[model samples]
Target: MGNINPSLLHVGSTLGAVFMALMVIFIRLKASARPVTLRKIWIPPLGMSTGFAMFVVPEVRFPWWWAVTAFLIGWFIFAYPLMRSTVFEERDGLIYAQRSKSFAFILLGLLLIRTVLHEFINRYVSIPQSGGLFFILAFGMILHWRVYMYKRYTRMALPKAPIPQPRG
Candidate 1:
């Protein structure tokens, strides 16, 4: 449609490729046996915030309902599955998480679905509006995932109750 910008496709594809590469590295690092720390759990959200900021435009006028819908969809599609699949454990006073590789495949599938939706939406909406929608969607998913991870990490890292001493 007339609203579609040819350059937007190039930019989105390039960004998607870079995101996929980073995700691969992220998955590998998370899958390692290193103890999970508050810092580690916090990093992804911080990085995602930066990415989200890039797509935000002052001129974009997206509807509140659309944003809410996008956020809910992102939460259910991305965050819920990720939270359910992650395996957390406590060993020797350290918290560790076993990252599921299947999540990467799931992410890829979601990305593909988003890409197709973007193509359809771009024909009807301005690029900034679509970009803003995507930003909110990703922000919601990452925020939910990080919050759950932080809770899980804290719960696992808590000190165990000491055994009661027998009366002497």
Candidate 2:
């Protein structure tokens, strides 16, 4: 295989991350315009599960410790803010993802952090390995956030039990 240029790879990955961030923002806006459903709540992470296939490539494999650490960091640190910023509301008897003022800023912040961390980690790891680690991190974040949302959605969607009335 031909040697790859580090500079080109860096630029390409950064651009790709930026493009994805923008798409997330656009999709969120569109999604908010309609009623949210249980199917919609679960689709993203389930669809994202397909990305686990990347591990089948030898170059993308990383140590299990690194994967665990990345997943934990994403779950404990990153997911918290995302969960807090994402909220749901009911309007006309349908649930919808409430528009949060902080959601966009949080996404931009995460993108910047990922870009900087990618530059640092690439010095010590191959590009594919770094991508794998980052992928784990992102999956953890999305999974945790989605689970939280799922729980909240179910609670809101469920019909409430009526309290027993005392005999007059």
Candidate with top lDDT is 2
User: Mind giving the per-residue lDDT tens digits that candidate 1 earns over 16-55?
Assistant: 7559747755865555579888888788778777765544
Q: Native-vs-model 1 lDDT?
A: 0.74
Report the lDDT of model 2 for residue 55. 94
Each prediction's TM-score versus the true structure: 0.76, 0.95
- Candidate 2 runs further than 4 Å off: 1-3
TM-score for predicted model 1 compared with the true structure? 0.76
Tell me which residue pairs clash in candidate 1.
Answer: none
Residue lDDT tens for model 2, 92-160? 999999888788899999999998899899999999899889989999999999999999999999999
**What does the lDDT read for residue 151 in candidate 2?**
97
